[model samples]
Target: MDSQEDLKRCPVDFDHESRTHASNWPTEFRELRGKCPVAWTEKHGGYWVATRYQDVVAMAQDDATFSSFKTFDPHSGEVTGGITIPATPIPRGLPVESDRPDWNMFRTYLNRRFAPKAAEARRAKVRKYADSLLNRVIETGEIDLVNEFTGPVPAMTTMELMGLPLEEWREFADPLHEMVFTPKEAPEYPHVIAGVQWIFKRCIETFHQRKTEPLGDDLLSYFAHEKIDGRAVTEEEMLSFCNNIITGGVDTTTALTTHALVYLNEHPEDYRRLQEEPKLLPVAREEFVRFFTPIHGLARNVSRDVEMDGAKMEKGDRVYLAWSAANRDPEVFTDPETVDIARFPNRHIAFGAGMHRCIGSFMARVMFEEMMHVVMVRIPDYRTHPDRARRYTSVGTINGWVDMPTSFTPGPKIETGLVL
Candidate 1:
């Protein structure tokens, strides 16, 4: 709860790091969207929470005014704040942390690797992995959906794409999942940082190895060989690039799928409907992305004074663009709260907007669709244990499940030799 003076300054002062807040942020966001769309808070060294659809889009589109780069200090020209609010312990690099010209340069090179057309080619692999994951648990009749299926699928996908050792998938996924819940000052924070550092060390080693002996056409190879500004990208830049991809690619789709599963399990009719109407899966995927925004909202550093919807934001201040709130805005989607699997023309900001829109969106779509389609068709009657489910403690970066225990009728495994 905020003090009276804080409430006077901004009607709704939110603490995104609060576990209770994260658990029921949707309810809080709904109230904020109606009461005070552009609210401020003293939490995380003070930041604005933009809850309206229009305000979020306006700020997301204006990267120059609301810069994403946070590590670099405007005062002394030295790297200071980490990427997100309640700032991350380590410094992030291009292009998520970079703005405009620099962002475009890095983004342009990586775009080709994640283009929609390029992602389509990975469909077989996606389905193959989905089936393979289900094969291990199909006969078990009980499993933790998040740990067994949702989490590993994308982890394996991203690792394969990065040319990392597949056996080390948990090493990459566990730390990332833990980092989502671990605050900078928490006891587990040091362990989380250590895990990330280990991943970085592995990525740096891969970058060096790929430089010496180029392997398959993977992302690491792109980083190792691709030259920008007439020169190869530095190791630090390469590490940052890898960090962004790993972080973006892993839990987002997992959380989206996890939430979708939890919802579908709760409403068996919707699950049956999706199972029966396979054609609607594509549209359903969009609805799921909109309804269950995996990464709730991201922070932006205000580069200059700006006014939006009668709210004044000062320069150097941080603003949180509530994507989850914007998605549920009644002004945007019809009956935004209700889950409509058939909802079309969904103009959601789940993937963000402007130059910073998620680059792995295409792959995320492919992975999600394949996984959803397979699960619905195969394990349509899967039951999730809500009592045992574990959700992220903070919505600062991701709204995800740490574990979702589920059980379904035992079934046979399909032999799909689509593995490369």
Candidate 2:
């Protein structure tokens, strides 16, 4: 057993990379919660670490005090600040880093596209896409599930939702991946920035096209025409909003889908149960999000001096709402380490809480549930290639697999052709 002093310094740092890469982190986190629920560390210029479920919940809900704006230096802080982990530097004018009145306006415009009804309406299409992808994988006998199946599903779905050109899908996908996986200080930073600039330029062109030649059903058209505060949204605001949706919707969903499949493969009993009881799909999807927590944690800046969980936090201090740690906090969950699809009233913060909660959550859930349903029906006997499961390595904000190779008996091809 580690001493109290040892426990405080166990994780000592809260950067995404250290926690994700450290095999004993789960144990370290468990020990910290008991010894010092809100521990401080000097690693990333000092930040308070909240390991209890209630603390994270309170912090997430108290956005007034724990501001989400520019929290920490993404490069060296315990809490890798920014909207993401590993803290890729976002260009100025992006709405995610903005707060209050401005944030409200941007979220209002985005809400319409990601509303539950809109996502629910697309269920048929989402299911069809999943089925088609699974069919392709089955035909190949053995396949890299991440790149071959999971990656493309969300990429295609997000493109369709955003009304982006089909040809540019791959172009956008590359930058989104780099922004999440590659650290800003890495040698590839220049290349990643160039890719992001290219995509932003294309987004600008697309916004212009939508303005003149409206694609009535797409999100860009909606934003182009919608009035905020009884006035038109500026081009710059639209660009940032679009960028947020593109990156958030694409990479997060891809990581989630990849994790869901990997989790199901590792627990065949749970897989069989899900297949047998299809109605449990919704519950299972929520569990998967809770279990995998694709977006690990988000950063928040202290708006005012406040004391919390024994730590004297000053105004302007950066703090991390560790969703991964919070979700597994035994104070709120029983057997926090295990996967329980039936864990009802499971108030996990995987999608976060309060206003800034994931705008595309409904869409993500739809994609996940629909994909699970399609896979259960089409490839029920799937199994993962143990040696090829590739976990992402970076002090970043998502828990995902780079590649998940799988083997399964191919199901009979459907007579109705592929669904676009």
Candidate 3:
């Protein structure tokens, strides 16, 4: 029904796998939105890009139409792609990749654990971890925030929450960090996949242990003990659930903290404001989430014929909800480019909307606030060398910094009673 000119006008050569393109994506997204809000891309087996805030939100809200299932073998016609743009080689995790009833079952059980109040209750633990990390670097006068602090805080916290071995934090965190950033052609790709496989094996062992002897209030125990449809959870479901929690819990927050530190270091005034007016940190956190949109956007598969913004999308087509672009939509936020630390009514979708919204959002917010507070107070005048920093490529998965070299005046170590 469409002519060559129509197709040419609608097609935008947007590739998330390209680092150069990812780096300057906001500009491209802006241009695309102005010309074609829902442009079709020939890249990655061809998919739709929803650039505007309204369009993205609408697609996200209608999960029935825009399914999260990943179709790996296009020839096989087997429908099973999760949120990732090019379906991840690994199995799709529970709740996130699943439709209702199953999704509702998982959420109902885990919701109480990640509620704001429960996350708040763990503030002391988070502070202890932050202080311990800062203590190691305060005397050195210089540090790599990504390797030393931001990466570890959430990884360690998630390990603690899951009752995973704290000693294995590096084992757990390394792959997640590398997988999201490294390209498939890079030498690190295979190693990262191996590391992820290692995690899967570890999760399976833990699941079995928890099933036999339920332990503390950790997620492992909950998942092991929780009954679904009056029967014990299967090994596959446990692996899927644990995988989702571990992967989701670590990398996203790490990327967020890294980005926030970089931004605040560039704009010292905002950093000072955070220190002087700690109350504003909550609102500022939301703004940072908006500005960074760390994970970028997630993908959804069209289950049925749908038309959006004058374009018709047929069933089996994949559409990407550009959260990062939507966050900067002029229609949604006035001067969306500018970072207003105290932006009120900041309804950002850094956390995906609808049934698949991030379960660890409350934990993310609490940890981010405390981490910022600690950094602002301890290393007030820290300076970052962007030239020395390494940013992630193929930001289709997560837009984050790899190495952030920072220096500040050496300060006395705090006596927080938290030993490294």
Judging by TM-score, tell me the better candidate of 1 and 3.
3
Separately for all candidates shown, the number of backbone clashes (residues 3 or more apart, or on different chains) is 1, 2, 4
Worst 10 residues of 1 by lDDT: 1-10
**Alpha carbon lDDT of residue 397, candidate 3?**
80
Report the C-alpha lDDT of model 1 over 287-310, residue by residue, as the tens digit. 999998888888888888778787
lDDT of each: 0.83, 0.72, 0.83
Clash tally for model 1:
1
lDDT (Cα, tens digit) per residue for candidate 2, span 160-279 = 777777556567666777666666578987898898788778777777788887448987777777777898877767776776777777778878877777778888888878878888
- Please give the TM-score that candidate 3 achieves against the real structure: 0.94
Candidate 2: C-alpha lDDT: 0.72
lDDT of 3 by residue, 91-159 (tens): 667778887756788677778989999899888888888888889889999988887788888877887
Off by over 4 Å in 3: 1-9, 70-79, 415-418
Top model number, TM-score: 3
Cα error, residue 368 of model 2, in Å, equals 0.3
